[model samples]
Target chain A: MMRRFPQIAPPLIALAILLVAWELGVRYGFLKPYQFPPVSRIASGFVELSTIGFPTGVSIWSHTLTTLVRVLLGYVGALALAIPLGVVIGSFQVLDKLTAPLVVFCRSVATLSLLPLVIVWFGAGELTKVFLIGYGCFWVMLSNVIAGVRYVDPVLVRAARTFGLHGGELFRRVVLPAALPRIFAGARMALGVGFMVIVGAEMIGTIEGLGALIMEARTFYRSEITIIGMLIIGVIGFAISAGLTALERLLLPWAGNLDAVRR
Target chain B: MLDHDNLARCALRRSEAPVAKRTTSPFLQFIAINSVGKTFAARTGSSISVLDCVDLTIAENEFVSFVGRSGCGKTTLLNIIAGLEDATQGQITIAGRPVTGPGQGQGVVFQQHALFPWLTAVDNVAFGFRKSGLNKTDRRQKAMDLLTLVGLEAAASKYPREMSGGMQQRVSIARALALDPQILLMDEPFGALDELTRIELQHELLRIWEAQRKTVVFVTHSINEALMLSDRIVLLAPNPGRIKRVFDVDLPRPRSRTEPRFNALYEEIWDELST
Candidate 1:
């Protein structure tokens, strides 16, 4: 406990010092409270958003849950479609070559840039937002899965072959397991992309998410509420990545240092 | 020294008491390699021959070792015998049938212990029984038995990553034996291990071979290892790899390096390798 204090102490002290300076600057009229909003105002904003609600009825909880639901839907949808397709593509050299250019082009196309076209097509509803997030995640996931499958240890295939395992049996038993660490790396990356896309996605034409709450607070001069919303988004993103790391650890006890293996 | 006197007597008795089929040679050739060759395409577009016109015969239940320098195609020859790689020009026959592909009663242990990381030691061993039609429980039980045979029963539930290098190689040996193959092809199975572990595993391997009575073709760069384990050692020369010589190790079991005969043979092989 005593040893850990040194590790934890520096960051806390720095944050405290920063907050005090901000409060002093605001009180001395050197800084504007409306823009930066002192720490105390942000704390009160958190309480107000949690209790009396942000847009007269919907609480911060509802906004967070809505954002989370959108991300989960997009992320899960992308993984479900990408993994199988990627495996097939990665297995065959002919197919991989044929699709390589298309995949690269699609991944290079910025997902948010398609928002205007998507809103025109899908009418700026939940589907439009979810589609944008899915589009962002799918390409990242697909490419990683393909790479993972393509680069399994050749010695493992030879060993499997010696045991009368060939064709699809070899792929399922040997290739898939060997590729799993890379696949997990891909999943973690895809989730991050999904999280980033959702925040930007929810900012436009969506009133029931953290992104929209912050945007609405900005127009109403509630800068403190906006800051609170941004903090909540950051916390949620941290939680999401932590949860994914935990899941990866749980599923792959045998896979030591997957990050080290990944490029 | 091992109890070789009794073993020699037993072999003599078995040969004398053998039934009807009479042959000029006392023991039948288990694996016959006839003018085998291998060539690979070079990056410069010219073809490079790795093995050229190699020929040899191994008797049933005999332990043979292929000793050679790097690039000598000893591994390639072993792979051909295991049916993992096809010979460029010649044919190999096992049990009177021509080799085509993997799965002709040939169990191979590579230099690297290629046990699947995801599976426990038992499961990796049981991988040999996947197509044998045994249910999961029976496979696990049989795998446990093989692990016991390799003296790794305590590590049956451990993953490959969790085990030491020597232990992992033991698991690899157990996994190969799970097939109940008539011939075991080992490609320098102890090459990556330290000296002590290599010697220990060498002893363990000899014990297993004695009990199983299977035809073993072991490939190694170590002359001492070849002398210690093999009934015959075939020396291979590189640069279009071909057989340079074949030495018969007629010395008694568990032969000592201090013995004059052992030192003489080692010197001869070392001189041959140096040239």
Candidate 2:
């Protein structure tokens, strides 16, 4: 514990020093409190949003929950469709060659650039937001899944052959396990893309998400509320990523150096 | 020590003995290679011969080693026997039937321990029994038995990466033995280990071979390794690989490197390799 204290102490101290300097700068009039928002104002803003509500009706929790639900629905839906489809496409050479150019072109188009088209097709509603998030996540995930299956170690395939394992048995026993670390890396990357897409996506139509809360606060000249909403979104993003990392570790105990496996 | 010259003469006389025909029973010729050849097509659209007209007969329960330098087709010949690779111009028969593909009861141990990284030692061994009709519990029990035979019962639950190279190789040997193959083909299985570990594994292999009495065809570049384990050593020469010579090692069991006769035979084989 004593040895680990040095490792953890430096980061905490740096963070504390940064927060103190920012607070002092605002309190002494060196910085505008309205624009920058002093720590005290942001703290009060957090309390007010949680209890007295943001727009006199919905609390900060409701906005955060709405944002989270949209992200989850899209993320899970994308993974559900992409994983099986990616596996099939990855396994067959004919299918992979057929779909390669299409997948690359689809992934290249900026996800947010599709916002207007999606809004026109599905209307400016929750479906548009979910569809945008799903679009951002699906291509990233599908490419990773395909690469994972395609690049299994040739030596491992030969090893399995010596055991009389071939075809489906070889794929199941050797290829799948060898490709898992890569697949997990793809999932993590897709989640990050989804998180970034959601924040931008929520700003367009909805007024009940964290993104909209901040946008609305800005229009009303409640800079402190905007600051609080931004902080909450950052925290939620961090939590989601950390949760996924923990889940990956728990599921694949054998997969080492997951970050190194990422392309 | 006896005179080196006398030992050389003795080894030469022993080499002339017809070891392959020692077994009188017709069924004893367990594996027969008849003019086996291998050719690979290059990207330039021309063929390169890897092995040419290789013929040999291995008796049942015999320990034979194929020794040569790189590109000698020793490993290729072993793969052909295992049915992992097809010979271009010849046929190999085991137990009166022609070779087809892997799973005809030929168990192979590669130079690197090829145990599945995701599986624990026991599960890797049990993989050999996947085609067997045993229940899961029974398969685990049998795998445990093979691990015990290889002196690794304690490491049954450990993953491949968690174990040392020697331990990993031991697990691989156990996995191969789990299949109870009629013929065991090992391609330099102990080549990567340190000298002490290699010698230890050689002893362990001899003990297991004595107990199970399975035919073994081992491939190695080490002359001493072949001399230590083989009843007969088939020397292959590269540059269009072909059998150069076959030596019948009539040395007694538990052969020592320090023995003058062993040294003499080693020098002769070393000379053969150089040429």
Candidate 3:
């Protein structure tokens, strides 16, 4: 940790400078407090949200947990369906060609644009939010998984075949492991999609997430609380991606740097 | 402290014994490539002939090399011999049995090492024993033995990416040998390495060949490499690839590049290749 001080110090100094500048701007007549929300107010707002609770009973922890659970459910559901379907589609050239246009069309449709239809189908409730998040995540994850399986190095397959491996045995031993780095890349991308979809999904017919908290606080003219909620969402997003990167490192030490694999 | 010259002489005598055996039974061909040819159909509807009517017969436990320039179909011929690809015309047989497809006792080491990046060195070698009916522990032990043979016992647990290019090739050789096949097919196995590493691996391969005598069919672009390792060097020509000439290298074992005979053979092969 001590050896990393040089690398860590610059980012810390920059963040401190930015916060101080923002705080001073609000203190003077340079920036409006309602729009910018002074650092001190946001900090105090964070403390109140955690302890005194937002809208009487729901704390910041409850809001964060609700958002996390919703994201996890949709993300997991999307992956569960996407992976197997992607593998089957990727393995057969005929299937891949047949579904290419359909997949592209579905993935192109905006997630939030389907809000009215989803609300009609599932009613504006928890089910509707989950369905929307799943929809956004599924197509991205599915496409990535298909590409992963399809683009496995031909040399690797040839080497395996020389060992007499073929059919399911070849797929299990060589193709699947070769495609893992790509699959993990897809999972990370899908999670980002799921997170983005949930925030928008939570804003509608829900008063129990960080997104809902921001929307509710803005209506009550608590700009500080809104800023605080936004900061929390950023923190959650950063933490989740970092956690995923760590998990990828632990699981796939042989994959080398994932940044090279991410396309 | 060791008598290096005497050891070389002993190795030379052993190597020469095969030549005498070959003369006695010239009809006993181990691997017979009968009019083998390969052609690829291009996107423009024109068929590209890579190899044409190539005929060569390798004796059992003999070291033969196919040497030529790029587009000479040396690797194409090796792939056909390895059963990874089929010939457009003709056929290849091992010990009188026609090769239908890959994996009938033919082990190949590719130029790129082709070691599965996900598996460690030991596991990669053990993969060759998938059909051996051996338990996991036994297979691992056998893999370790092969690694030791290639002087890479310490790198048994290392992944392919963790090892150097030379070390990866050593692991690849170990994996190929783990199959304990009747013949070993190598396509420029050390072609990507530096000159010094390539020379060192050439010696290492010779040592392995002496220890485990198998019919070795090696493909290389280097005439010097072919001269250094093979008993007979089959020079191939490109543009509808065909054999130009076959040179018998009767040099002694532990052969030096500085030797007059070695230089002469190199010049002869070079002269043939230039035309």
Candidate 4:
């Protein structure tokens, strides 16, 4: 049924209707200026944040770039540590048993819960924010990597062994490739964790990232800027996920979209 | 360490012996009851016998098949042959030396294709040659050659999902043959394909087999398939699994289901299998 209609038309019309309703509600005094800001006001706010800048000097682009850098740095650090370590734990049953409880406890602990402790240790610097982001991303990635390596089908390993593949050869050829789809899922999840942590971390002590922009705008009653900041954050999150999906497609061409290698 | 050359000479001498004829004439010869058996510990701390006093010799370049229902220890026997599982009771000697574990010219093809999804058809085949003495350029060329032999040259660069079920299994066969093993142990490699694709591949496999002439011990439930492929079929019955019957298929190459002899043997085996 949907195929018969113009593909983009329905969604476009729905979005237009929503914007009109929102704009009219504010103008007619049915909705307040603070909680639910008008679309027109948010549009002006986008322009203001880009040119006039938010919090006096830094523009929206600078804040987005800063946020992006923090997420990337933290995410990369977490993966670098987690992937190898997870492979070690996952490959060995004794090690998996030994660390199972520790991993479970760590993952259950809230990432934001570490914020105060991190600030105390690192003195509220960029290092503290990065550490929190890494901590959150690390656990998520470690678990996924462990799951990836552990869940390799037994048949493939048997097939590999018959071909003179044993020790490192078996692990590299059969286990690693077999576990790739799951490992790719872990990387994607870790990035998301890093993004979420950065937002919460940036809100605390930083004045240069998007989260900070929203906090600053809220205090000054420029709530339209706060709304704009949230939209930008959402857009960035969506783009990052979509980018990772494309990367998965390019790297793991055989993967089905079955979420079998779940995050 | 008397010497590997001396051992090879002894293996050649023993391989020429008469007892090797009853089993098979495959290059990778395995002789059994003089070999050994396997035992498994039950969950209740008791032990169960998987294979007991079981010994069979295979000749060079023979086509053999093992047929049985699930839990009939057919797969366990195959696993033992592949050296994936150790025997608890007896000893197995390949070419006069005791079987230790996997990796002495044994290549495997599985029921599920088991082709690495991330790899293209050519790359998956090449994975078998990773440990080969050949260099990178030669290994790749050899893999491509094998793919061509399997008639998947047109789809050589395609991933497993991009190919048909039959094509993937053909790629799997090519992957197995890439190692140039003396024996190929297949665990229902074509069982998952549809009827049409499966029959087409059966002919394709026959062509490849004629050229390669490797020892093949296939496992399957399809009576016609076993008759069509095997020079000898070993049937096992469950409940403390053991060999039930062995049928020699002497019908001509490229066998037919409609053939009187083919149907007769199928009926005989089917009766034994059901009974």
Number of the predicted model whose TM-score against the real structure is largest: 3
Native-to-model Cα distance after best TM-score fit, residue B46 in candidate 2, in Å = 1.5
Which digits, one per residue and each the tens of the lDDT, describe model 4 over residues A1-263?
77867888889999999989988998999999887888888988899889979876899999999888888888889999999999999999899989999998998899999888888899878898888889999999999899889989987777777777788878987798888888888888787787777768987878999878888888988889888888888898888888888888777767865355433
TM-scores of the candidates are 0.90, 0.89, 0.92, 0.89
User: After superposing the true interface residues, what Cα RMSD does each candidate give?
Assistant: 1.0, 1.6, 1.1, 1.6
Residues B94-140 of candidate 3: C-alpha lDDT, one tens digit per residue: 98888888888899999998989889999999998988889999999
Model 1: lDDT of residue A134: 94
Q: How does model 3 score on DockQ?
A: 0.59
In model 1, where do residues sit more than 4 Å from their true spots? A1-6, A29-31, A220-223, A259-263, B1-26
Task: Arrange candidates, best DockQ first.
Answer: 1, 3, 4, 2
Give the alpha carbon lDDT tens digit for every residue of A1-263 in model 1. 99999999999999999999999999999989998899988988888888989897889999999998998899999999999999999999998999999999999998999989999999989999899989999999999999989988888999999888898889999999888888888888888788778767887887899888888898899999888888888898788777877887788888875657433
Candidate 2 lDDT over A1-263, as tens digits, reads 99999999999999999888989999888988878887888888888899988887889999999988998899999999989998999899899999999999999898999988998999889999999999989999999999999888775677678777898989988988887877888888898888888867887878888878888898988999988887887798788778877887788776655556533
Best by lDDT: 1
- To one decimal, what is the Cα RMSD in angstroms of model 4 from the true structure? 5.5
- Going through the candidates in order, the fraction of native interface contacts each one reproduces equals 0.77, 0.42, 0.60, 0.74
- Give per-residue lDDT, candidate 4, residue B79: 74
* Per-residue alpha-carbon lDDT of candidate 2 for residues B71-150, written as tens digits (9 for 90 to 100): 98999999999988998877788987889998888988999888888889999999988878789999999999999999
